[model samples]
Target: YLDVDLSLDQVHLYLCEYLRMKDLEGPYNAELVPVVTKAHRSDAVPSLTQHELDAILFEVTEANENPEYPAVAVLFQYDAAVAHNALGVTGKAQWGVLAGYDRERQLARIIDANAKAFGRSWSVTCEWLLQAITGYGYIVMRHVGRLLRRQSVRGSASM
Candidate 1:
């Protein structure tokens, strides 16, 4: 209906590239992570669970106290409304962010583009949120101070 329909992979890359470009942006660059998928993967896929997400976030938070990529968020792909169970789109592959959580309150906030429930962000019970989300893997966003040179050592040797 619009112009051209894009696959999830394309969408993911677009998002990643967008963030990379945002590195030129002012404040957003200070805390941005680019790329949405593994170079060899086509889709993010459902590979994680709610509990796993919680653990990852907790670790990221703890690390951010003094480490790299201080900010990390989960992008969930599910078949429910971004905000409430009865407020927006459903029965489709909708995406949203698990901005953060409150273990004490047992709540997780969902930030969405089609949000209308809680003014672009919705706070729902973790149980409900987990039940409604799919793993689909999300990129751990961060602020890169400089280019990172990665290394590879294989062939069963330290090299």
Candidate 2:
């Protein structure tokens, strides 16, 4: 239903959300680093102000349970790539390039799992239908109302 033209970058953002959900990473959240808007030389690394750095550190620190060396280090690397525009190319390609694929697999798994769950009761189907309908325009709403009413009549007759 969303008709906006999503660039590869925007698609990456959706992928991030999908990966986080599939990983069951409850506390994990990612925000695009503002550095993406800045013009930078190909060889220059993106820089963050102290506050941005602190916020990122806070997220990772909070995510850590034991704060052991390797765990913190890995967490730091993950967040750092996102916080800087370092997610662009080669030397940092493992973080950025790989995230795209990781997110794709995670999204596919979630879609598959959701499709399986959709084979459920009529209550679920109705709930989903209602939620979707409510997001539409007034003219669409009238059609949805008539459809629901017809469905209700048919449902009662079957009972």
TM-score, cand. 2: 0.26
lDDT (tens digit, per residue) of candidate 2 on 47-76: 433233333233333333453421221101
Q: How accurate is candidate 1 locally (lDDT)?
A: 0.48
For candidate 1, write residues 68-120 as lDDT tens digits: 44444455554465336675555455556666666678677667644642357
lDDT of 1 at 139: 42
TM for candidate 1 is: 0.54
At residue 18, what lDDT does model 1 achieve?
Answer: 74
* Global lDDT of each candidate: 0.48, 0.26
Tell me the spans in candidate 1 whose CA falls farther than 4 Å from its real position.
1-7, 24-46, 59-70, 81-83, 86-89, 116-118, 135-137, 144-159
Q: Which pairs clash in the backbone of model 1?
A: 33-142, 45-136, 46-136
